[model samples]
Target: MTEIWQRPWWFTNSSKPLLQPTWSYLLDNHGSLLHSHLFSALFPAAAYFVICTWFSCLMLIGPSQWRVPRPQILAVGHRSPSERECVVHTLLLSLFFVLPAAVLQSVLRTHIELPSRAPTILELGMGLMASLLLFDTQYFVWHGLHHVCPGLYRSVHAKHHQDHSGLELPISLAHLLPWGLYGGPAYHDKHHKSHKWHLAPYFIHWDRLAGTLAP
Candidate 1:
């Protein structure tokens, strides 16, 4: 058996076709559509609108919960890059991490057999719902751990919180390196601290199953 890490980016285990490989195929196809939309005027405008809206919401809602006292933010940066630089660098690093994971998932799908019959629209909807729920659960658990533990938080998770303190961005494994190495506490810490509210991130189920969730 190939080590999970050693498996080719495209190789999924043969037995779990629907569960593992299907997700990649679906996401890749969906992403392709989204990419194509970038060439059209409407999509870019819509995307910008959505991004702006999201940022606005974060600024208004996230600060109350995610903001560390200015002193805490400054203290964490003692041996690291400035907050602005850290955010930019970590964001770039996260993109690098996510791109490969996405490619690997796509490669894994190539090893599986796709549905022989066209999936009914209902089946597609069900699959999407299931995937989303699973992802959220895993993300929440994984994120919670970056706060509950300190040693693991510092070495593998603190990188994200090194400068910033907040849950403005959607959390995911891709963001882990940034959060892990830099400082944000999976963004959950902010929510926990601010509102005592705990909601799951979108992709939490996978991390939980993979044993990568912090707590």
Candidate 2:
């Protein structure tokens, strides 16, 4: 008698044979070695890049702009994120978006072979341009959504605006829900609050939209 674990879920003593079995049958027979190597490498790299870029930008740019203020080390009776929660949130973001996109890119590259070429300075510039476009799109989509959808604004976006003053608040460290829904509104909130004092716009063409050259 075949072991229950070894047999397919659909297989039974009286069941008819399948004409075309599922892909899982092929995988079970052939094993995962048939999977492309490019997929494995690209996934982790993409995950690392996204997480690092977001965290770095938040820490470096947010602080300099005074969006996130330095917390007083000596302050007492304040509710902050636990170390474990921070790590978990970071991991969740990396796994959900970054890793999946990288995997898809790798799988596409493997399945559809492209011309091999060496990296050049022009390629680097193109990559930078692409990154900027991606950031801008994300920012604009986020901001527009907030303006259009008041329900989303009240639940998630409200946390960002809670900080009235632009200086010295941990804007990035606020709820992760906002980041998931509206990308970079916490940073934008600072720009909105300090429109007069701020120098350059963070992402959106707020000056052009508002019809003011100055920040």
Query: Each prediction's TM-score against the native?
Result: 0.39, 0.42
Whole-model lDDT values for every prediction: 0.49, 0.48
Write candidate 1's Cα lDDT for 1-215 as tens digits.
55766754344344444444555665566645534422233443445445645654565567465433432443433764565575465455545654455545554543334443334444566787678667676666676676677777777655654544344345634465443532233435544343223335443344445554455
Q: What is the C-alpha RMSD of each candidate to the true structure, in Å?
A: 14.2, 18.7
**Model 1 scores what on Cα lDDT?**
0.49
Query: Best by TM-score, which number?
Result: 2
Residue pairs with backbone atoms closer than 3 Å in model 2 (clashes)? 68-169, 69-168, 69-169
For candidate 1, the per-residue lDDT at 2 reads 55
Off by over 4 Å in 1: 1-87, 104-110, 116-121, 159-199, 202-215
**Off by more than 4 A, model 2:** 1-84, 97-112, 154-207, 210-214
lDDT of 2 by residue, 90-125 (tens): 566567766676767666654443222323444445
